[model samples]
Target: MAMQDLDPSEFKTQAPDAHGQVSTLKELGDEMKAKLARLGLMIAEEAGAGTYLQRDQTTSLCSTRSKGVEVLPIRQALQRYDWLKDYSWVAVKADTDKFTRDAASAPPDVVQGYFVRGLKGQVERAPVQTCLYVESRSTKQVVHNIVIAEEGSEINIITGCLAHGGIGRAMHEGISEFYVKKGAKVTFTMIHEWQEQMEVRPRTAIVLDEGAAFINNYIALKPVGSIQSNPIAYLNGDNSRVMFQTILYGKGSSRMDLGSRAVLKGRNTSAEMVSRIITRDKADVVARGLIVGDAPGAKGHLECRGLLLSDTSRIDSIPELDAKNPDVNITHEAAVGKISPDEINYLMARGATEDEATSMIINGFLSFDLSELPPEIAKETKKLVDQTMKGL
Candidate 1:
């Protein structure tokens, strides 16, 4: 049979089967909701979107919820705010069924996302938030969100992912696409908080127009069974800018392979990729970053840092840069090692126990300078970041 002739949903481990057996647990109650809220999402809970999804008794499936009580689909959630009406869950099954490169132009319905309304030359005032919660057994879920900032406009978006208790092995796959038009700026922040047994895969891509800017921030503070992802950004127009910042903590027997790639294809384009990884227990982690400059006057930098908390844990940093233009500037740096005992001793000498001293060092290392983000977004995400650092 031809590739196009097969059943599109048959291979989907997260999609509904012939007998409609997609959910591992038939329904969820208050207990699971509380669990989801406390698992590194107290900020989201305070914002009233902690458990952004819930199960409807009649359907036995999960749906996006508003305020923990009102059952709302992503479409309806988009309708709540007039400013969000321009956005939607536009990706089709074609986008999420596979890891194809055409996701930005041809998105499948299986993907959940929206298209931001572009302003000819203005900034959007409201910050968009996409909160998701998955609590099903034998479940595999995929999310694909698209954002397009019109020329001369600016916008901010925050994406949060969470899974219910570790009942069985559950999976979540995600894809995101961003189109920054000429002179536009788009800032995106991703927060992943899943249980120990869940698996996650996130695929993201971005395209920038002349003078456009794309800022990406990623944080994973909890232990997961496994996660593998690589997000790519393309600076295709003159003077475009793309920066990626990430912080992760991998624990237990988890495995994490995360990376970011930037292609500077336009004159005077600039890019940066920074990542920090901390591993504990038997976790295996890799931090990968790459920047390619193909245009004259393009400049880019890549950096990766790691901290090993357990002797059996492993952390690897990979940084790469490819420059085709002699006039361009590109550089990369990577470092992986255990926390320095000298740093801990210094803190301990200042009136703290060994545990407290170690905690302080770990927290300081894991904490990021939010000054890199937009004012509003930085202010909002700082709380979540602080909570994550302390909890870990």
Candidate 2:
């Protein structure tokens, strides 16, 4: 598939505010509700502790039900608390790239993203759910998100990015920065489902303090025109830890480039990066991972696996590990291959059709041992994976 250069000025930056039209998710049309559910947004009590929903350039909902956590619009949060200036653009520079520059320079009328903060020593029982949807054609959505987990606090977040089917062409640029203070833990899970003609670019960076832990899970299953994302994490304090898991499915003539990098700069710090990619039809995919150990007693690992379902599809895997200290340990493993006929035939002999057998094998291949995730979020992630496999 041929790619075109992105021109920010060509897309509309303003749209009508639909926030007052719907008071709750249940009030939306049934079709729209179902679409949101597929991206891990629900109306149940356990859905999340807070909810933030944005449609085009308008914020439909932003509220926090939990006592210890605070959720507000980014612009409002910045105005309410002057201390936020110290954290903003600290983890991720505003001028890092073209996308970041554009997002940082967005007009004041555009709806900025949401702000989430976990107070010191407070733990939220449920994750915070946020959804960013593009409903207008030829629109440009620029969002800057910030997440802060105070010392000894823990918070989980689930973000969904989707594009309306009626919209013909659109672009999304998201900038996110996360801070995990000493002894704190933060988990973020993101699901992306967009139209085949949509383009997406997300820039994210994380900073971890002493004894902090961060886990990130990302999934993109639906067909899309183009997507490029590479998020980096810095373990700057002693005993800090970080883990990343990404799942990507490429279909039609889409192009996807996704990767993650981690730098272990603290003593005894550890990092891990894992990716699973599957391409069908004439799609193209590139999976990349990098881990650097810069302190003594630090450890890191990188793993990437790719599967090809069609002859015209393409998959590329790149894994790199670097150790600057003699006492550090770093390693990487990567493999790319197609389904073996013998394995498929074995499944077919057990009273299963060809398609069924193939699905079974793919399911088994995508199976993950993620004991770190909360039970509810884990179940939702599994459901999304199963639905995607069935669709394929």
| Number of clashing pairs per prediction, in order | 14, 0
Candidate 1 regions with alpha-carbon error over 4 angstroms: 1-111, 349-353, 372-376
> TM-score for each prediction?
0.77, 0.95
For candidate 2, write residues 1-392 as lDDT tens digits: 33336665667665536434456777766766888887768732345788888887787878888887899888899999999989888888988977788877877667478899999999885878888888778888888889999999898888889988878879888889999999999999899998888888889999999999999999889998898888999999999999999888899988998899999999999998888888999989988888889999899888888889999999988788888889999998988889888899999999889998889988887876567777777788899999989888
Highest-lDDT candidate? 2
lDDT of each: 0.66, 0.85
lDDT of 1 by residue, 193-305 (tens): 88887767667788898999988988887888777788888899999998888988888887888999989999999998888888889989878888899999999999888
Q: Candidate 1, after superposition: displacement of residue 2 in Å?
A: 28
Candidate with best TM-score: 2
Q: Model 2: what TM-score?
A: 0.95
